[model samples]
Target: METGVHPARQPGCHPAHNPRGKPKRPTGRTDGPSRKIEVRALAEELGATLIRAVRRDADDELASVGTGHGPVTISWYAFALEYLDMRWPQIAAKTRNETNAALCAITQVMLRDVRGRPNDELLRRALRDWAFVLPRPEPHAAPPDVRLALRWVARTSRPLTDLMDPAVMRAVMQALRLKQDGTVAAPETQRHKRMTFVNAVRYAIEQGMLDSDPIANINWRIAKTAKRVDPRVVANPAQVRSLLCAVSYVGSYRRARGRRLVGLFAGMYYAGLRPEEAVAVTLPDCVLPAEGWGRVILHVTRTQAGKKWTDTGQLHDERGLKGRPPGETRPVPLPPGLVAIWRESIQTFGTASDGRLFFNERGGILAFSTYDTVWHEARQLGLPSDLVNTPLAARPYDLRHSALSTWLNAGVDPAEVAERAGNSVEVLMTKYAKCLYGRAAIANHRIQALLDEYD
Candidate 1:
């Protein structure tokens, strides 16, 4: 039924005129699809006065029922039912009154049938059974219907209304985990679903329905080591050098699969650039000098979130680096060799239509197929079997870890290294501390030299 305020009495009735009165109990029993009683009876039962509905704003057909708690009006409900009767394809205007009467049955449900069920369980059931599923058949979706279902479910879910509480939010969050199809099956998957569930719970609490927010208590702790796979396994320095030396800047061999792949990994390793960030580099972004090292300034990168699924193989939107508050840039210095590779790459494969450093033959964003194909060729040619089997050097970014660690082991100061690599000292130390094992004896010898001075 159409639901909205009635014209004659949009503000409802005043409590002073109604006073408190006990409702009249139903004396008769009728079966088969419960029907609404006369407005007088309902008004009396609800301790309200029946206001009649009228054709215009001041008309008389509209009715208002009064009560000590608030005014309970029936005119709008009757009008709404009439409106629904007309709108239904199968119902005739002659049946409008009856349909209106039936629509009013909802009052009984509101006042009696569902008054005390646990809100959370009800919301969970609604989400599981209907919410997204039921709306797919419709042309457009009504978020409110879904929200109301969720709200009602929350109201009925029991003593669990607060969102800030860790346990409560954890439970709610657990409900939104992404299923295999990429929609919210539970609370984790993509960031949006997690945030949505958290916000919904927070909304319930803010509305004064719950006492606390359960999510506030969650501890966002890191439970695993952050090291990239070792690059030595993928390609050692000597192997990398050999791979780069084999490619030329011209002809079919220049366009041969491994040239770009070699340049890609070498750039990632020596420049310490993330794949998305590295892919955004253009001919203009590369600054090379004739005799020494140069720099590659990464002005854009692609990151995905609610707008795109990670499994879709979509490109990250062009944007500044992660954690760089908008407007800032991340610049990585290029070793002389990598600069040489990029110069050759540009001469071989012309810049993408948009001046991007990399693209497919059609000038579209480079696809994973191209990347993987190039990588496989470079892998077989540039890496040994034992190192290839190990995890440390399994992927492109691992080369970055290798480069960063190599610099650190060469005795680069942590602060200088971190700044050059677009990382903080804390991250630098955490990720490559183990790589420093090879330099431990050298450090120990220095410590001994200091001790000798004391002696």
Candidate 2:
């Protein structure tokens, strides 16, 4: 058995029936030092002879199992925690948040009884934000009620063996599938949850607690996940330009809340930068010369995973590039219009102490709520009545879709677009660059002396 996971037979299984079927080092040899114990008095009571004493100590069965730390005695919550503890150092902050969320959903249904349970919402908060994650900021300082809720959970949570029961597994499946409102979860979310749960079950099997993985024995399928960006959400250039114009009008000229984000939005629309990448852009990353195409070399992303999950205890964490290695950079060509915008932005806003091009009024990282409100207002203000009701420019990220699809529609080479967009050529062609239907066809109309000739 792996170290620290006490070898246990839940109910039906033995060490010999361990999932790996590699015989456990005959009992007490696994966790710590083993020693010989003569059982002459006990053997005499059982009418056994002394001739078997000459056999190797390794051949003897363990006199007793682990003291209270075995699977039968451990709660499912504790087992799941141990699984996460083993995995913590191997995963990123965002992944840790995701794992915490998945386990929270699974844990809600892992209770022994609800006889004296606390409010469901409060219990979930205690699990999701505090108890499930470690290195938490001042863990002992959790609010009194939250501490009480956690204690209640530890007292009422079912044994790890309950996770193997078919009925409990079905409840777990249901909890993972539907939200509290009874709506089906997103496919990717459901898949993440199942993957986390399966890993926990496999941990049990690895510790010689189970004959097989319960999740593997069950029949279940996650709904299909989407790979390609929806073509409908990809805004074209004209709509994006109008939206940028409207965004500038969002707040009073003095506050400049909406005006501050104009250049930020332009980067995504003109250069295909992701929202997180655009937020982290610093003055040093840009090169805006007098006339021609400028350049922006990308390095990091400042993204949100909540203060509790982030190592910095801030709403956002600055991390390495999404799919690229540390310090690897992607260079994107900037248009002359964007260069002019950048020059104006630097003069007007002056940048944060760290040279970030855009920030909140207090010169801090931009919150999602702030930008989302700005974008929602811009859609209403910029789009035509009919178009506003549609999905055009629905999200700030769609400006990037607008940029990349415009490149593809304008017949740019796939490899070149991929390089500029920081995507593999396959992803550029299949996911990011789906051509919009109307942009090219309605671009212009010619005037002729005879209208029939044009038709």
Candidate 3:
């Protein structure tokens, strides 16, 4: 039989009496120290003892089971680092950043209530900006504040086993639903965080740390997502043409920034290329004819995820077309007008060194900010004052929206529209549903004709 006394409480461990000659209590509190300090110290000791006991029991159980593998006693922070390492080579830059962000968010609620913990803001920043980017080669040590906060998190984070508890999982879900400012997060943001967390838990299950993903058992309500495109932002054909013309007139006396981007904007309006896809259009991608309609074979997109997210530290990452497999191509048929625009652009500006059709004056990739500034200036120059301030074609992306809407409204088959827009039929029907103007009147007219024939 063993006594409940810790090793520190052994008979010869310490003097039985205090310096003031008071007898030391078995509970180990002395009357000398400040109460707050004593309480904090006691809490720290208790936390450490509890952690050690839990780990020891887990180890003992594994040994009894006769398995060679060690117990799953990793901290949440350590597991997060391991998971990111496992995933880094396979995922896209944007996805990598999102994974890091989601893990950082989860870390906030996964810590034990340790004394002397860093403030919430500091800890969050440290996790997101420093601790979670495990794959990156450290250029330098983190700042003192971030390093301190990171150390606190490493010391205080709950073990991976804690995530198996329903209550702890519930806390994580609640944290996912809120922004750093404590306001409700956007629906998309909530969805992304939940998806990342669920995937992480799934990975945990595969690693034998969890029996099942606790998130699957949780009865949580996800905010409904808004699927339809706002009609106000959809530009009509005439408006798009006017905008394209206005783009030519912008900075005409300067570096011809607007002139250089005309074909790029045309690709968005007529060929329905995403801004990223348009930026990446090379000479080999386009099938430009002198007179008739041409086609663009889009194989890659140059998406601008910040340098820290990309493996190369480049501002843009060259990835497969959005939602498409690597090396798969999407061929979008361009209208004759767009073909004319492309021909003129190629003749005037020529291609970049790497054969990309649209590039800056220095032949580098066109920055999104540069094009956005030109588009805004073109809007002010082209649109009527009232329309200029409204959401009509507010973003370069809105142009692609308008193009899809136009194709749908023109009685083009939904399947064809979806293929051209590089979207699923379901997404085309759901997102661009409201933007398909004049469809209601056409449906009403057809109904009226049928009713008249019956009469």
Candidate 4:
């Protein structure tokens, strides 16, 4: 009789089948060939049915899910893209970039652990440089390898439902706390990432993807961070004057490049203006009297956050003074020394095309790199070797700290100092508390006077 097994299923297909003869059965089996064939077909049919049922169930689960704003059937990658689209237009460029970074960090752990994984470094680059910057026009096409890696990630990323798991949330927090080298991130960086994650989770809740923020349920401890200014970095009055004099000597061949910044640096030392605010100061903003104290009305500040993080694609972003609302101005009184310095600078160098008191040779806004280089050289020239290695006025920003500390130590009211420095009184007292030298001595003197009366 002819067998039901096809000729294609002969000896070569299985060791049990003989090419020259009928197929052989196991020695212990008594079942007939037809019965075995029926059983095999039935098993195959059941497997197919089971697979189809599983796929159907998955589809149903996805369909039933909804984010408060819309459906939650999308993968994490898709959801992140949608979130960026909604937020891109409403936030500042720096904020957008920071959010992108945080999301990229979160995405690192929001993937399924699948086979054929890409190199970690390549995958990280793809997420940070391409996937996260969703709204920005890509400057160049990704390489073939990067494209392939990103495609793999997109395909294997977990769905939004997976984020509800406490384990997944833990993974995200852990990822944010680590650097690329697997070391702990800096405290400030960790804090920023945590804030970003918290905001994103809150957005998820709003959309109805999550019922609540998982971060709130977890107890996470960040490394201790120092918020106070170090007194060691503060420069004394004599040292500041010496540094200013040295600034005029830097790049002496470049038509007094250093000299142009002397007044700018002096403004930071005298008026407690941030470097950005001082750079944004204009002729109209200043009311420099002939001999007495003058005033500077600071309504705006120009901060450099790089072209990529600025909407105008310029190096600096002009915004309202830090922590202040637009159109609000802070009037900082300039000491007589700064008034003289400002008047002399205007008389000698005139103003930029826009009336900015400070500018480069082309009458453009001063480049941060140029001023930083000038400061480095001046520090070397002005500070003695021992002090040079120390933290005394180590950075341009230190000048502002030094100025604020000087004001506090001079017994200036905390509220008045806060107004001049564009900071809250609490911040002034907390951050500069350590920098207020001689306060302990004064307190001790008062205590001694009380003791003498008792004696």
Q: Which candidate is the best by lDDT?
A: 3
| Per-candidate clashes, comma-separated | 47, 0, 0, 2
- Please list all clashing residue pairs in model 2, or write none if there are none: none
Candidate 1 versus truth, CA RMSD in Å, comes to 17.8
130-203: candidate 1 lDDT, tens digit per residue: 32221112313435454455334323322322233455445444434433233543222234344433443454
TM-score of each: 0.56, 0.77, 0.81, 0.81
Could you arrange the candidates by lDDT from highest to lowest?
Answer: 3, 4, 2, 1
Quick one: how many clashes does candidate 1 have?
A: 47
User: Comparing 2 and 4 by lDDT, which wins?
Assistant: 4
Query: What is the lDDT for 134 in model 2?
Result: 75
lDDT tens digits, residues 1-455, model 3? 78898887876555562456555567855575587887899999999999888655543432232211266477787678777777878888888878888898898899899897888888877887776774543524678777556666766778887887999989999999988888999999899888888888888788777666677778999988888999999999999999999999889657898999999998999988899999999988789988888988999999988788888888899899899888999899988999999889899989999999999999988889989999999999999998998999999999999999998999999999999889999989999878776798898999999999989
Q: RMSD, model 3, all Cα superposed?
A: 10.2
Off by over 4 Å in 1: 1-209, 215-235, 242-255, 304-314, 448-455
Better of 1 and 4 by lDDT: 4
The predicted structure with the larger TM-score, 1 or 4, is 4
Question: Which is better, 1 or 3, measured by lDDT?
Answer: 3
Query: Candidate 3: where are CA atoms >4 Å away?
Result: 1-69
Cα displacement (Å) at residue 199, model 2: 3.1
lDDT of all the models against the reference?
Answer: 0.52, 0.78, 0.84, 0.83
**Alpha-carbon shift of residue 281 in model 3 (angstroms):** 0.2
What is the lDDT for 282 in model 3?
93
- Candidate 2 per-residue lDDT, tens place, 273-309, comes to 9988999999998898989999998999988778867
